[model samples]
Target: MNVLWIFAHPEPRSLGGSLRDEGLSALRAQGADVRESDLYAMKWKAVVDADDFGRAASPDRLVVGATSKCAFETGELGEDIRAEHEKLAWADTVIIQFPLWWYGMPAILKGWFDRVFVKGFAYGVQRPDGRTARYGEGALAGKRAMVVLTAGAPEATIGPRGVNGDIGDLLFPLQHGTLWYAGMSVLPPLTICGADRVSPGQFEAAAAALRERLRTLAIQDPIPFRHQNGGDYDDDLVLRAELAPGRDGIGVHLDT
Candidate 1:
């Protein structure tokens, strides 16, 4: 299987980096064709600006969405973004490995999404009926995505009643809103909690868990996030009253 491993850790010797190495080794041993984007090592550009599109000469104020859409369609996107697009296109599964920062992804990774996943390529797409094709259908449909995160907090703290909140809820924006919105089937994430204090034993356990997850990456069932237009949501894109009637949070979007 073709796999794209997008790693976003600055330190090659850190826990996150160690896991990335272990995961890659396991994937290769599994006979998977793996391509990796080591963001920090590449010194990846971490901002979206006029430089992303080739048509910066236009007199119109840079409408990023429209400009990016045009650039993507006409092959005018920057080489770096195009290269990433090509890599993504070649792979059926994308493994995003990063340390969760501020309850979200690192700036470089977020910028990677901002710059690479352009409007026409990843969003601002629609179906033939003129309805939006996102949250379940879009250009990236049929692909699978998985996140491998390392968070500083203890696992218990990220549970349902923990002060830091449930890990699933914290990741909904990326898993459901972005990945699923872009039409990828998001597999359940592999999270290494209390990373700073991980013992040798803990590291071994985490590595084993990651290897198992990687081995089953292709056939594993994706997180059952409800589709935006799958009759669970209304014309306005709000979840129908009939579904999750009593719940009123991001967790309600899950097909649990």
Candidate 2:
């Protein structure tokens, strides 16, 4: 299996880096081909400008997603984005590894997604239904993805009633909005907590767990999220969650 691991940590000698190395080694030992996108080491560009489209010379082409017809005319990128896209195209599975910064991904990693997942290629794909294609059912469908992250906070502090009020809620945008919307089957994430003061033994355990998880990637069951166009929902179909569980206006009963 081909796996693309996108790592985004400033320090290569940090705990995140060590986990990355251990994960890579385990995947390789299992005979899986792996590719890495080390953002900091690559000096990735953190901003997205018209120059990214190779048409910056034309002032009129400075619009985002305006490159609907703009092909990759120029074979130039700052090496990082180029390698990332190539890996994305080649991999069947993707593992995004990073330290949670400000309750989200590092700026560099977010920028990577913004620039790499472009229109016409990543999204804007069309189907025969005349509907805007991709997201729920598009080119990126059928692939698998997971986030293996390290956090400085203790696990108890991010529980449903903790200071953060559920880590899952914090990750909804990334796991559901981004990955699921893009048609990738996202597996449950593996989050290692208390990285700020984790002992070496604890770190080793986390690394081992990650390695074992990667080994079973092909058989992992994906998170089942309601499809936006699953027919039971509508434009105004607010999740009947608050009013009454499993109740829908269209007589469709959802599993609460």
Model 1 CA deviation exceeding 4 Å by range: 53-74
Q: Which residue pairs in candidate 2 collide?
A: none
The lowest-lDDT stretch of 10 consecutive residues in candidate 1 is 62-71
lDDT of 1 by residue, 1-256 (tens): 9999999999999999999999999999999999999999989999877766434234243332322322235256677887898998888999999998999999999989988877767876656577877898877888899999999999999999999999999999889988999889999999999998999999999999999999999889999999887888888888888887888898878888
Q: In candidate 2, how many clashes are counted? A: 0
For candidate 2, report its TM-score. 0.83
C-alpha lDDT of all candidate models, in order: 0.86, 0.74
RMSD of candidates 1 onward, in order: 3.6, 5.0
What would the TM-scores of all predictions be? 0.92, 0.83
Residue 231 CA error for candidate 2 (Å)?
1.8
Residue 203 Cα positional deviation in candidate 2, in Å, after optimal superposition = 0.9
The superposed Cα distance between candidate 2 and the true structure at residue 92, in angstroms, equals: 0.2
